[model samples]
Structures are given as C-alpha cells and as structure tokens.
Target: MQSITLKKPAPFEKYNQPVGDRYIDVLDGVRAVLVLLVGAFHIWQQSWLTPHFTLFGQRYSLDFLLRSGYIWVDGLILLSGFLLYLPYARAEMGKMPPVGPFLLKRFLRIWPSYALNVILFFFLAVEKYNGNGAYMAKDLVTHLTFTHTFFYDTYYGSPINGGLWTVGVEWWFYLLFPLLGRCYKKKPMLTALGMMTCAFVFRAYVSTLTDTRMWFNQLPAFLDVYALGFIGADAFVALRGKLLQSGKKEKRLFSLICLLCVILLVYIAKAQASSSGQEGIRLGQMAHRFPLALCLLVLMISACFASAGVRFVLGNRVMRFLSAISFQFYMYHQVLCVQIRERRLIPSVSETPNRDSEWPWQPVFTLCSFLLPILLGAILTYGFEKPIIRYFEKMRSRKKK
Candidate 1:
C-alpha cells in the first residue's frame, strides 16, 4: 500500500493562524522522555528485580523510582491539553479551522490506532477468559465503549489492556473541549481556576465515598492538569515573540527554574515513597498531583524558550523520531513489556539466582521493551493512522469545495 502524505499548508493559507509557538521541537523531546520513563517503570515493575538490593554496601530499593514514573502520565496529559487547546484557542480568535472539523480531526487522529489496540486486546481477552462468560461480556462492553474508568468495579477489574484507562479520560476531554474553549476564550485565568477547583473538590468528595485508587482514572481528577495546559496555550499566544527573543539572562533563569522543577518532582516522589511505602504511594500521588502538574507545566513552557544547549539536546534527531511515534509506543508498550517479562524471554542483570540485581540483562530487556513498541508504533502510524487521517482530511476539503 502507498504511504499517505499530508500536504503542508501554504504560507498564506486562508485558515492558517499564527498561534504562538507554532511548533516547538523540544516538546517532542519531552514526550520522548516521558514515554521512556513510563516504559522503564513498567519494565522495572515487571522484572525479576529483588525488593531490596545492596548498592555500594548500602541496602536500597528502587521502588520509588519506578513508582515515580506514574507522574509522567500526568506529564503526557498536560502536553495533550496544551497541544489540543492551541488550535481551539486559535479558532476562538477566528484564525483557524472551525470547531467541528477540529473535533473530527482529533477523533480521526486518535481512533484508528486506539481502535486497533482495543480489538487486539479484545481477542486476547477472549482467549484468556475461557468459560468466564459474564465477566468477559462485561469487560468487552466496557472496553469497547471506553466506560471502563467510570465504575470502581469495572475500573479495578482486569483491564483488557494495561495502561488504557487514560484513553477514556482523554476521550472525554476531547468531547468537552468546545465548552472548555468557550470558557477559555472569555476568561483564560478564571477557566483555569475553575477547572482546578472542580478537580480538587471532586477528588475530595470521591475520596470519602470510596478508597479506590482508580479515582485518578476519571477525567475530573485530571481537570486541573488539563487546565494548566489551556492556560499555557493562552500564555504562549500572548508571549510567543517575547519568549523567543528572551535574552541570555532570561534563558538562564528559565533553565534554573526547569532544573528546580525537576528537583522538586524527584524530591516529592522520593518523599512519598519513603514515608508512605509502596501502598501509600497512590495516595501520595493524589496528594501531590497539583504540584506535579505545575512542575510539568513549568518544564514545558521553559522548553519553548530554552537556551541553545537545552534545545539541541531536546531537538535531537533520534528524540524527534521517538516523539513522532510516541502515541503508538504508549498504547502498546505496557502490554508487550508485561508479556515479555512474564514469559521470561530474556535474562535479567542479576548474576545470583535470587533475582536481586539483573543489571546487564535488565538494561537489555528495557531497551527491547522500548524499541519494540517504537517499531510497532511506526508501522501503525505509517500503515493505518496516517492513511485514515488523510482520507478524513480529503473528505473535509471536498466538503469545503
């Protein structure tokens, strides 16, 4: 089959909007890092690493490092909100495509790859279910409809595919974007504050009703994170020129702030792991969600105005390639990694049979887990996603004509 190619918009295209920071290559680098972090966390969790290991004669556990990987999911959420909101913000200014086409474009962009995974997982579940009729039926219905995150019983149940709960959350956000766009267009700061307030209040109320950690899977719990992105979009539009022309001192300041955000995030993750233990990590994550989101927002915005050294690192060719396939990588990595670990397809690092430290082999497994997803993601992107997206764009264009 021929590959699909999307035509670039002409310089003076009628619908083109000079949205702030049209494309920051560094953000792709950030995405590459986030996906890898989440990938590494999954590998570490599934590996045969012992609960405790002695490093440099000191006993330590890397559980916190792995647990902290969950925060990157919020990072992904923030990025999505930022990117999606930009076009909507532009549309609000009457410079971009209409809301209907934008929504359709979003649906077409996400659904093909996501639907394929859902189908693949559905069949996998069918094989695994055997004679468990009722549960299988329920899982199929919930997964198909993306309603798996709404109910405690269903959310906590055996998910057809691991790491897909976010799909439901993200999909709902897409549905509500038009409403959120209206709020943002009228008063960006109030919209952001309202979203944050609603998220905190909803989370607090839900905590009283149930102790389910899956509460984070709901869209309400992530409203603040999404809102932060919306705010960032508005900021970028208003400040893009100033940000790009920032002087050496300003760039240095942004770098320092980015570093501080990283340090603060690591500190919070470590503190949660140390004080709460593994079980309490979820509650810790909940408690620190706002802080984590804020740190991510700062990092993202800073990356836009980063110095040459930072830009070079983030905009490297390999990082950009990884970022391009990030969606597919994210969608497929957990399932593949878990299967590889469960099957013991490769050796781990630990020389001893105690499964304590699998250094060399652990790295190999991690590399494979990361690469295999990219390979599959590349195929999905080229073979399925792009073609379907192009087809939809053609339909929209023809309608316009």
Candidate 2:
C-alpha cells in the first residue's frame, strides 16, 4: 500500500512550504458553512419558516435561498475538487499521490461509519422500510457499494435513506480524481475545458430526455463543478505568494472583492430559481451550475487572501471542529430531521404535522436537526472513523518495519 507520509512543512514558513504540505483550516470552515446551509434548508422544508426582514420599505425573505440549497451542494463538490488537487497544484511537484493510499484513505473515510450507521438504521427502523423485502435488499446492496445513484428505485424511492446519493456521487469523483488530476497537472486549461465540455454535453443530453431527474442526478453531470474546483486549487497555489505578501490595502481590497462575489452568487441563484415547472427546474440547475461554481471559486480564493477579519469569520476553531465531522453530520441529518417530523417531537397545534403549517417551530426543530446529528457525527467521528483510520495506519507502520 502507498504510505501516509506527507511532505512536512513548518507552520511559520508559508512561502517556502510545499503548497499541499500544510492543512488549510479555512477549508474546514467552508465545508462547515455548506453543511449548515444544507441542514438548515432541510429543516426549513419541514418548518416552512420564511425568515424575512423589512429593508428600505421592502420585505426580503430567505425562502428562495432555502429552496436553492442544491447550489450549496455544488459548492461542496467543487471544494472537494479544490482540496484533493492542492498537492498537485504546485508546478514543481514531482511525485504523484499514490493510488492505493488515496483509495484506501477515501474508503476508510467514508465506509466504516457509513456502513455502521446505515446498518443500524436498517435493523432498528425496519418498520419504516418502504418496500417489499426484495426491493429493500436491492437498495441495501446498491447503497453499500456506493452505486445507488444509478437506479430509479434506489435514488428516488430509497427504502432506507436517500440522503446518501451525494455520497455515491462523491465516491465516483474520488475514483476518477486521480486520472483527472494527472491530466490537469499535465495541461491545466485543456484538461479543465475538456471536463467542462464533457459535462456540458452530458447535461445537454439529459435535458433532451423526458424524465431528466435520473440522468441529471449522476456524477458525470457535475464534472464541470469538479473541474472548476481543480482550477481553483491551481489558481490559489499560484496566488499564495502574492497573498502572503499582501499589505493592508491589498487585504482590504480582497475582502471587498469576496463580499461582492457573494452578492453576485445570491443574484445568480435567485435568477436561476425563477423557472416554474419541474423540467425547467432541472434544466436551470444543470444550466446554472457552471456560473455558481465560478462564483464559489472566486469567493473561495478571495476569502483566502482577504483581511484577517474575513479570514477569522470564515476560518475559526468552531467551524473547523464542525467540519471535522461534517460528512457524518451531512449523512445522518436527513434521517434525524425526518425523525423529528415523523415522531412529532416538536409540539404542534396543526391538524396533521408541523410541516403542514407556517407557525415557527424553527427553534426546536432546528436545534434537534443541527445539534443531534452533530452529536452523533462527533461520536462517530471520534469513536468509529478515527479509530479505523488509526488502526490502518498502525498496521501499515508494522508492515513497513
């Protein structure tokens, strides 16, 4: 197996260090923010709370923002692309990341807790299973192998959980990233353009289809987002020298630029969400991902080079801690939120359910949705995932000896 030995860089020597040698704490913050958006969006679906304020004699509500949370998922995908390619972003880098170690680490990162959690969910809540035994078996098989996104039944009618479709997409990205990374390393612009063009073609094909949902939800459809991420990583590495050398004036400019990029992203999202029908919605999502990814990258790179205040707001200990367990949190939250709705945990005067009404039970449901998954995610992160990874590392060490 490929060893876990990374090129060590001194924390203080930012300029002299290898681009991928050190941890980027801000990325954790980014992931944390995206995860929170996703969680809140899901919670909002249940609570039906349209958080709004009166500004300049106009009422602005976040209902549109919550409705467009899929864009945030695109951001997360791009961030993953940015992160994985950072090691290769440096032009002087010679050795490639080993395939075995990369796959091994990715596997350990995902499957251990995933398997454990899903298995528990399956057995403990067998009563909640949606279909017959055969159907449920098929779903379980597909989910465990990370191939559930390919099918209609499992992807749409997940008997156990549908929240993991993104995980399936991410696993495919992981498998393809090494090849894509090598191509990007050899020819950055060409490789990126090729990936984007391929994704564009795929989206175009999906748009032509009658039921675009199944086709649009696959990994191939999001190649442009990943390509943008790779480009972002490359650009950030190229710009780090200038960033580190920036004065107060430059930092202030960067902060302003980042803020503007965020505003543009909001505008684009609102405009894209204007489509009426289901088909139009799918088309708009496919059509608008590129621009959204572009905006996200701009914000990402700018935030990295922005003022200390911007960096602090975006990159702090709390954010990093949340991010550390973000995957588990993201994975478990849907079930937990559904449970909150299903079990009627929060008090409601509605005839049927809380989601059926507009009264703000946001506080109770939001806390349960965010806090419970976080607690579970933290426990799984420390209790299961870390131990599995450390065990593999220890085994690798002994083998080397």
Candidate 3:
C-alpha cells in the first residue's frame, strides 16, 4: 500500500503564509460561485429557448445568456482537476510505496457522500415511480459503482443524480493522477505544462475527427479539462515561487498581465461558441478554453501573490462556508430541479414544443436545484463525510504513532 509522505511545512517566512494556507478556501469560493451560477442558469433555462417575458401581453424571448450557460459545467470540470491535483502537488516530495492507499483514501472521501446521494435519489425516485424495482435497482447499482456514463444505452438521459456524470470523469482523473504525478516528479513545472499541452492536442485531434457531441467521443475529450486543471495547480505553485523572488512592482505587473489574459481568453471562448453551434455551449471543452482557464488560474495565482483584498474575500469565513458546501450542492441539484419542473410546482406559461407535459426544465434549474442539495449535502457532508474523513485521519495518525 502506498503511504502518503507528509511534507513538512515550508520555512519561507518572507512570503505571505496566509495566502498559501487559505488557497483552498479561495478555491472553495470559486466553487460556490460556479455552483450558484449553474443553478440560476438552470432555473429559467427551459423557457429560454423561446423566451417570453410578459407584462400586459407584450412578450419577448430572452434566451441568449441561458443557452450559453452550459459552459459553466466545463469550467467546473476544469476546476475539479485543478483542486484535486493541488494537494497531491503539495504533498511530501519523496515517493510513496505504491498507489493502493492513496487511491483508497480518495475513494473513501468521495464515495461516502456519493453513495448516500444515490441511495437518497433512488428511494425518492422509487417513491415517485411506484414499485418499478428494475429501473431503481439499475440506477442504484450503476451510480454506486460510478459507471453510469458507461451505460449509455440503458439510461443515457436519465439523471438520477444529474451532475454525477462529470464525477465519472473525475474518478478516472484520480485514478490517473499517480502516473501524472510521477511525470511531474522529474521536472514539476514542465511536466505540468507538457501534460496540459498533450491533453489539449489529444482533444483537438479527436474533436475534429469525431463529432464531440457523440458519447463515444465527448466522454474522453473531458480528460483535457481535468489535465488542464492539474497542470494549472502545478503552474500556480511555480508562479508563486517566482513572485516571491521578484519585487512588489513585478508581482503587480504579473497580475495585470494575468487579468488581460483572462479577458482575452473569455472573448476567444465566446467567439468559438458562436462558430460551433449548440454543442459549442461548453466553450471550455474546446481547445480554445485552455487559454481562458489558464488565465483564470494565473489571475488566482496573482491574487495569491499580490492582492490582499482578493485574499481577504477569498479567505472570509462566509465565502469559505459556501465554498465548502458547493460540492455537495453540485452533486444533488439536477434531479431536484427536474422534480420541481415535472410537478409544475414552479409555473411557466411559455411553451417548449415536443416536450409536452414536461415544462422546459431550464438549465437554470440546474442552478436552483443546488440549494436543497446544498442543505441536504451539508447534513450528509458533516454527519457522514466529516466522520468518514476524520476516521481515516485518525487511522493514519494511529499508523504513524
């Protein structure tokens, strides 16, 4: 079994330690923001297709932004890779024995929360469907094993836990991390950059040859997003080192450049989406997204290095709390939104043709659905996730002793 070699805390005292300490907290804020955005976009999105806002019978479609909201998921995916890789990058420099315990730790952290959500969703769905044991059983099994993405034919569109599909990709990313980490052990920065580049190239080549909207092609292309994030984590650490060496003016200049890069990348992503059609919604998935994601990452790095204001907000208790719950919110939201729409608990007069009896379940519902899940997820996160995590930590501590 691989033992995690705990890296001793760095002795560098000149650089701001608070920023480093609260880096994950900042990420949590970003995570919260993204989750809320996704939820809000999902809420009003169903009618967004043929948008109508009426005040005394004058109606107009307002669908422009909502349609594009799907890209947020890609952003979320990229963020996942970055955050997941951050810890591993920061861990003990020396090698662990093997991958076994490392993988087990990860599995334990994620699965408890995940399995609870699945069981909850299944029972709720079963209650609604009434004794359709086969369907519920199938969903429960697939979800528990994290193989829902593989069973495209049996339940392609069925969203037991709507946001969970990305998790399938996430698990794969984790499994591959040891190999990715090994490459970085030799030359951390370059390896990160190279992996990011290779991922982009792989996706770009595959995307052109095969229709990315197809499950066969699209599923694998996601690796690019994950890799980009993992690379971003490495790059951020390197940039921090450089900033520590440079003067304050240089750090500020670096931040300014990062800001400009972010703007340029956003513009490019928007431009690409315009050219690509609906599948183009997730602009981040396209190779064009690498620059934008990179820019955002750099901006974050710059904030860590140069800006106290950014640091304060990022490390603020409220923001951290929201961010902590964001993951739980993300995992359980889609189905809740769907249930709300299906029951017509939330009214919408606007019609979506060929989807009769099913109100256009807006993508914004994806956003709105996040709330209840956040609430429920928090309960689960604390009551379940916290305990499980602490249990592992305790076990590790005992082993060390």
Candidate 4:
C-alpha cells in the first residue's frame, strides 16, 4: 500500500499562511531538550559515571550520552543558524525583513540577560583571578566583547564560565548573519555550500597547528554546522509547506520521519562507541560535525512535521516554559554544578574532587544541577529579561510613530 502518493508540493503560501515565529513551538521544545542535555553532561562531568545495561543478550553502554554533550552544543549552534537565516529562507518566497530591526531585536534579546549573567559570574568566580588583576581584567574584557573564544586563556579553561564559548561563537555568527542572510536570500544552497567548504578548509588549516584543542572550537570550525542549519530551515519550510498543502493527513510521512530520526540516533551512538578519545570528543568533533549536524537537522525537521500529539509532547506548556528560560538555564547550570561541588553543598567523601562523587552525592548533585538552573533561569527570564525586552520594544514602537 502506498503511504503518500507523493507529488510536487504546491507553492508554500497555498498551504500555510506565512513564515512566522509563532507556530514554531517545536523549536523551543527542542531547544529546551538541548539545553538540558548540555546541563546533564556538565553535571556528569563532575561525576564520571558510566551508565550501561544488559538486554536482549547483549551488553550496551549509555556512557556516550553524557560524553556526547558537547556535540549537542553543535545542535544548539545549528538551531541558532536556522533561526538567524529563517527569514532569508522565507524570503525565497516573500519579502525579507528589514535588516536593522531584526538585528536590533536579536542583540537586545540576548545582550541584557547575558551581560547580567557574565557580570554576576565574574563576581562569583573572581577567586580564579587569585588577586591577579591583570588576568581578571583580561577575562572581563574578552567576555564583554564576546571575543572570549578567540583566546586560549578565556576559552576551555575560562575562569568565567568555560561553557560561555558557545555564546562567543553565536555572537560572531550574529554579527555576520546580515551578510550571510543576504547571501542566502540571493543564493541559499550556494551560500551554504560555500560556508561549509570554507569551514572545512579552515578546520584543515587549524589541524596543522601544534596543539589544535584550543583553536578547534573557534567560530570557523563550526561554519558547516551553521550552514546545515540554514539548509535545514529552508528544507523544513518547503517540506512542511508542501505537507500542509497536500491537505492529506500524513501519518505515513510522520512515521517515516520518526524512523529516520531513530536510525540516525542509533548510527550516532554506534559512531560514538567506535571512537575512543577524550581528545576534542574536544579533538574528535571536526571529523564528523557535518554528519552529526545533518542528523540533528533530520530530528529537528521530524519534530516539526510530527503528528499533533508528538508535536504537543515536545512543545507542551512545560517545554514552552523551559524553552523561554533555556538561555539562562544553560548559562547557570555548569557553573552551579561546580559551585555545588566546591561548596560541599552536597556531601562528598572524595577529598580531591574525584570523578565519582560516590552514590548519594552523585544523584543529589545531579538533581541539584538540574533544579538550580531552572530556578535561576526563571529568575533572570521573568524578573529581568521580560521587562527589558518590553522597554526596547516600546522604544521601537515610539520610533515608528
């Protein structure tokens, strides 16, 4: 029995009204999940617990789940790429947004909340300065400018939230998005290919360096990730547009997308099992970032095109709430995990901060790691983020008048 008598999808507008952010609930849900994955990995970092099991007469390890957290950061990066270029993708069908308002909104949305957190953490982690005024000053400067990733001192071992490297990368992407978006608007596939090609060349160049770990995470390394996001956005819009246009319930298409997502997940786990290294897993990313990003794209698209029940499962009210505060959650979780260990908030017998914080504390610390981020993220999002955003928006309206 044929599932979908697939045919050329009608023009996008014939199905959906327009490309607007309101209906993209699944994206926020996925963002919530990605942030949680990253947070879990960081929590696991303090306690290197390998969770495995035996089933169906075969032993399998879920260890890669935590180990692969950093890779999921690429997923977040890809999401950023999708969002930044989504307007351009839609412009393939309709008019593009004015560059200035869009840029202003993006910067205003991120900077206020981010700057507050960075400054707060600066005070919290100031001990890392060790009375070395020079280093503290340098770290603060780089963070303020979003150039922290460009320097070794401010990157992997950064005193002010090592996880912040992603912010720096995203900021760079934002600064360049206008140009990238325009290029994509004019020639999307070509622009994506060009970005991916340049990224590969850049990675090859960086690999030649004496110690590539410090340099591997710079923005250029993840260009392909961003490029994939652009491609994914365009594809999602077109595919979903057509799906809606068919006016036929696509249970089969939904089933196929879900199966493909599952297959990709299994394939990735197998790849992780095959690879053995702690080196760039910081060392290993460059080798397979594209395929992984592609897989992420599939999952993201699948989520979007899923059945109403599946979409609601992912984009439910709870997920929406978490997604709203995901940025703050991500920023706070790892740092709080470290604080929990350092302050002995959870009892630990490991005198030297051992990998296994032992049974009670491991679970306790991980649980706190999960909860504290939400509490803090909610505080920042509700208390500070909303009011500041409204203020800027009002100013924009006044200017329009």
Candidate 5:
C-alpha cells in the first residue's frame, strides 16, 4: 500500500496554514456565519410572524433574507471541496496515502454521527412504509447508502431528513475527489473550468426534464459551486506570495473589487428571481450560480490576506467554538424544527387575531427553535461524535506503530 509522508510543520504555520490544518480560525468564523444563516432561515420559514418593513420606499419581507440564506449552502459545499482537495494537492507534492485509509478516514468522519441521526429519525419521525414494497425497498437501500441523489424515481426528495440530501451529494464528491485531484494537479484552471462547464450543461439539461426537483438534488447541479472552491484553494496557494508582498492599498483595492463582484452577482440573482416563467427561473439559477460561486471564492481568498481588524473579528472564541460543533448543529437543527412545527409548540399566523400586534410569541418560538437544537448539537458533538473520532484515531495510530 502506498503511503504519503506527512510534512513537518513550518515555523510560522500558525500564522498562515494551508486548508487542511488543525485549525483555521477564520474558517470557523465562516462556518459560524453559514450555520447561523441556515438556522435563521429555517426558523424564519416556520415562523408565523411576517416581518415586513419598508426600506427606501421599497417593501421587503425579512423572509426574503431568510430565503436568500439557502445560497450559503453553496458556500458550505464550496468549503468542503476546498478542504477535501487540499490534502490531495499536498500529497501530489510528495506521495499520496493509500486509498483505503483515506476513504476510511472520510467514512469515519461523517458516518457515525450520521448513522445515529438516521436511527433517531427513523424511530421518531419516519412514516411506516405504505408504498409499493419494491419501491420502498429501493428507497431504503438508496437512502442508507447515501446514493439517493442519483435516482429520479425513488426518494427524489429526502426520505428521512431534508438537510441530509446534502450528505448524499457530499459523499459522492468525496468518492470522486481522488480522480478530480489528479486532473486539478495536472491542469488546475482547465480542470476547474471543465467542472463548471459540466455543471452548467447538466443543470441546463435537467431544467428541460419533468423531474426538476430531483434534478436540483443531484450533485451535478452544484458541481460549479464545488469547483469554485477547488479553484479558490489553488489560487490561494499559487498567489499567496504576491498577495502577502502587496501593499495595504493594493489588498484593500482587491477586496473592494471582490465585494463589488458579489453585489453584482446578487443583483443578477434578484433579476432572475423576478423573471416570469419556470424556464426563466431554471435558466436564471443555472447562469447566476456560477458567478455567485466565483464571488464566494474571491471572499474566501480575501479573508486569507485580510487586515488585522478583519482577522480578529473572524477569529473570535465563540465563533470558533460554534464552528467546532457546526456539523452536529447542521444535522440536528432541521429535525428539531420539524418537531416544533408538528407539535404546534408555536402559534401560527392563522391563530393570531391581531396581525398588527408586536407578535410576542414569535420571538419565544424562534429562540426555542434556535437554542434547543444548538443545545442538543452540543451534546451530540461533545458527548458522542468527538469520542468516537478519538477512539478511531487512537486505533489508527496503534496500527501505524
């Protein structure tokens, strides 16, 4: 079995480490922001209060902000691609680890907690199989194996957890990473563009199909977003020297340019959203997502070379702690949200007599939805996930010895 030599740490490694380092505090900050956006979006979607207010004579609902939060999932996917590709990129400079151990590491990192969630939700939430026995068996098999995303027929939507569909998408990406890494190492720009092109073509073709919902769940639809992340990691490694050598003025100007690109991308997405017809919506999403992905890449790159003020803000202790437990939070939040909604724990719009009133109950419901999941996530992460990971790590170390 082939094994890579793990490189010794540089003296200044703590100052500016690579993507797969033990800690990238800024990234934890990024995760904090992403997870909060996701949690807030979910809470706002289920809440009864309509938070509408006027800005510059234009009426906007807070729900619009919540709806836009879904875009952060793309950011999350991008981060995954960046981190996953980093080690392979490093290995290319030396030797690659045996494929079995690499794959095992990925499986162990994700599957234990995921299995727990599957079992919990199966007993607590999933409906009994009342459909055709054959189809039910197919759905169960696909869902269990994290291959549900590929099928158009069985379990097009998530069978167990709505948020878990991303797991299926990400698991495939993990499976494909070795091959993708080789192409990326050979021709970084060409490979990135090719992946983006394939994503666009797939999304465009899927738009014409009757099963658009299933298409949306497919990995091909989001490949560009993931590709942008790969490209971002490449760019950072390639450009770090020049970026660090540049003056403050130059760095600020570059950051401004990136920010403008993001704003422009948002405007384009808004235009597409307002366009009439389903074709317009699908085509718009396909076209707009690429640029948005690029924008996210730019922001991540900028954060790496950001000024002290920016770094300090992103590297806060609380944000880092939240980031540490983010996976657990992501896995559990939706389940709790669904439970809260089903149990009628919160008042609905229909139940309220005075719609104009300050809606006191909404805050309480929102707090419960946000806090309860986080509390449970803390338990799952510290109580279960970390222990299992440590045990496996110790076993692997013993084998190495």
Candidate 6:
C-alpha cells in the first residue's frame, strides 16, 4: 500500500485580541528574569573583587560583571520586538481595525514614568555637569524631545544614567512604528531579512573602522536594533500560525532544531567572550550578538507557539507578575545604585585611592541597594505607570461613548 502524505493546512487566522497562551506569559517571566538579573548586575558593581591577569589586566570588580551584563540590553531589544508588537501584528493580520486609541495608549504607557524619571534625574542628579551650559541645554532639550540619540549627543556627561541610552533608541522606534506596521503588512519576510542584513552590515562596518567615531554619532545605523525588534514582531505573527498548524512530529523536530540553534549560538557567544583578543571582542559585540539576539527572540515566540503544556508553563501567573514588573525594575535600578553610592551606604573597604577605586565598594554593592529600589519601583509602577495608562484609557473610552 502506498503511504499517503496529507497536504499541510493553512495557518490559523489571527486574533483581534492579542492573546497568546500561558507559554507567552512564561516568556514574559523570562523577560522579567532578564530585567532583574541586569538590575542586580548593575547594583553589584558598587564594589566587587578584581581578578588580575598579568598584573596589568583591569581589576575585575563587581562592576566588571555588571558591565558584562550588557548582553541583557540586547535581550531587551529582542523582547521589545516580540512582546510589544505581537498583539498589534496579530490583530492587523486578521484585518481587524487597530484599537481606536492604539497610539494614544502606547504614548501614555511610556510617557508617564519616562517624564517622571527625567524630572527625578534632573533634581536628584545632572548638577555635576562640567560641560558648557549650552551643551547641557541641548542635552536636556534633545532628551526631552527624544531626538538626542538620533539628532544630538546628550548623554555625554553628568549623572545621566548610562542605561537611558536605550530610551532614546526606543523613542525613535515609537515614532516609526506605524511605518513598520505598514511594511509588515506589505512584505514581512523581506522586511525582516532586510533589517537583519542592514544591522549586520552596520555592525560589520563599525567593527572594521579603527575608531568607530562616526558609528558612535550615527543615528540611522543604531536604529537597526529597534528595527530588528519590528522584524521580530512580524516573525512572531507569521511563524506562530505556521507552528501551530504543523504536525506533532514536525513540531517536535522543529523544537529540537530551535533548541540546538539557541544552545549553539550561546556557546559561540561564550567562546567569543573567552577569546578576549581585540578581534574576538569586536566580533562578539558586533557579529555574534545580533544572531544571538534574533535566536532569543525566536525562542521566546516559539514558547508561545509550542504545545498547550508549554504555553501553560510560559503564561503562568508568576510569569505574568514578573513581566508586569520587569520594565519598572529596569528603570529603577540605576537611580537606586546612584543613591546608595552617594549615601556611602555601600562602604568601600578597599584601600585603593579614590581615583584608583574602580569598584567603589570592596564586597560588591549589588545586593545592598536592591531592596529599596525594588520596593520603590513597584510603588512607582502602580502610582505612575498604572494611573497614566488608566487616565488615557478612560479618556479614550469616554470619547468612544
């Protein structure tokens, strides 16, 4: 008897509501885990032991580990593409009209805490500026206008948290989201590949240049990361339906391949880190990481697309809580670290001179400043983010009514 192979079915129709199973929510938990880990890394930098290589190697302070956590930033960029755009992409693919207040809702979601963070930074920080007053003004204006990363260099000095650099990048993404949506609707696969290629080329160019000065000041190039997020969003919407429709054998096989890819990518990244030669570092930063980030984004969406059991694990209540709190945790950490440093609450027992004390505290300040910020960030999220979101939503509802 001849074996009959059934033709594959078409993908599932998209949903109007941005619902993913418990798996996606579990991915949210993963996001929160990443956020908290990065936060802890930052706080840990206050003071930690320095590992010496050849006595000339830079002291391996707690901050060194924190700095190494830069990978988390890449994780975040990927997650932004996966989570933020998932709902809309699904709705759009289904031909449902976008929620009436989509842009307004997003604006309110981001603006409140962002605005508050800036104000808080200005009052509590920013006074340490040694640059010209004009530079300071330009910085303040550009940051407020969300044009600093693309149009100006505002984060050069002062107590402006280093973490805020991603904010400027994110704002540019917000401005271009509609265009991204249109592009996804038109030819998502092409758009995804194009953006990924562009990101690779930009990073490659930067790596080759001895002094990446131009790349440092360049806006269009840096926009690639955020654009990658948009592409990831499109992929999530496109692949999810296909994955769901695949046979059990195919699904299992695909899952195995994806898992292998992720493991291989991570191993490559670890190898790149270990190489430590100038070339290795550059390649690790510019070349290996983008693929790693893309793979991470894929894995996240895969969890959502996986079997019901997988989805249940991903969307569990604990995961949802973590996802909800992740953003707040990310933003609140730097301020907390700074405040602790200022108060000398994290004591530096090291005898190194002030100039030489790269790690301020001897024992690692990561754990010391966490409790306060975690507490405060949770409060602020409730007070600021929730209220602003609710206010805008209420207004939108009233208008519709």
Please report the candidate that would top TM-score against the real structure: 2
lDDT values, one for every candidate: 0.76, 0.81, 0.63, 0.77, 0.71, 0.61
Q: What is the C-alpha RMSD of each candidate to the true structure, in Å?
A: 7.6, 7.1, 9.3, 6.7, 7.9, 9.0
TM-score of each: 0.85, 0.91, 0.74, 0.88, 0.83, 0.75
After superposition, the stretches of candidate 4 with alpha carbons farther than 4 Å from their true spots are 1-22, 50-60, 92-94, 245-249, 349-357
The sequence of per-residue lDDT tens digits that candidate 6 reaches over residues 43-105 is: 645533344444466543333334455556667766766655666566645663354356666
Give candidate 6's TM-score.
Answer: 0.75
Q: Whose TM-score is higher: candidate 4's or candidate 6's?
A: 4
State the lDDT of candidate 2 residue by residue for 1-401, as single tens digits: 88898889754343222223257656777889988888877877776666789999999888778777666888899999998888788645478877788989999888988888768777756665654788778878888998888888878877466678888899999999889999999888899999999999999999999989898868989899999999888888878865566777877887899989989988977976686788888888888888988988998888777766777776778987899999899988878888788788877777455556535565667678789999999998998899999999999899999
Screening candidate 2 with a backbone cut-off below 3 angstroms (N, C-alpha, C), the clashing residue pairs are none
Model 4 lDDT, full chain set = 0.77
lDDT by residue (1-401, candidate 5, tens digit) is 99999999864444343232334567778778878887777776666455789999999765444655555677788888877776665555457556677788888888888888876775563455554567666666776788766776544444566777888888888888887877887887898888888898898788787646666647888888888777777777666645646666765665576567557756754555465465555555666677766777777767666654454556678877888888988988877876786676766564542243436667777788888888888898899988888999999899999
Q: How many times do residue backbones clash in model 5?
A: 0
lDDT of 3 by residue, 256-325 (tens): 7656755765565455446555444333346455665656666556556654445455556777777777
- lDDT tens digits, residue span 63-123, model 1: 7767677778888999899988887665645554467877787788887788789878778
Least well predicted 10-residue stretch by lDDT in candidate 6:
10-19
Candidates sorted on TM-score, descending: 2, 4, 1, 5, 6, 3
Instruction: State which candidate, 2 or 3, has the greater lDDT.
Output: 2
Candidate that beats the other on lDDT, 2 or 5, i.e. the better one: 2
- Of 2 and 3, which scores higher on TM-score? 2
Model 2 ranges off by over 4 Å: 1-21, 91-93, 128-131, 353-360
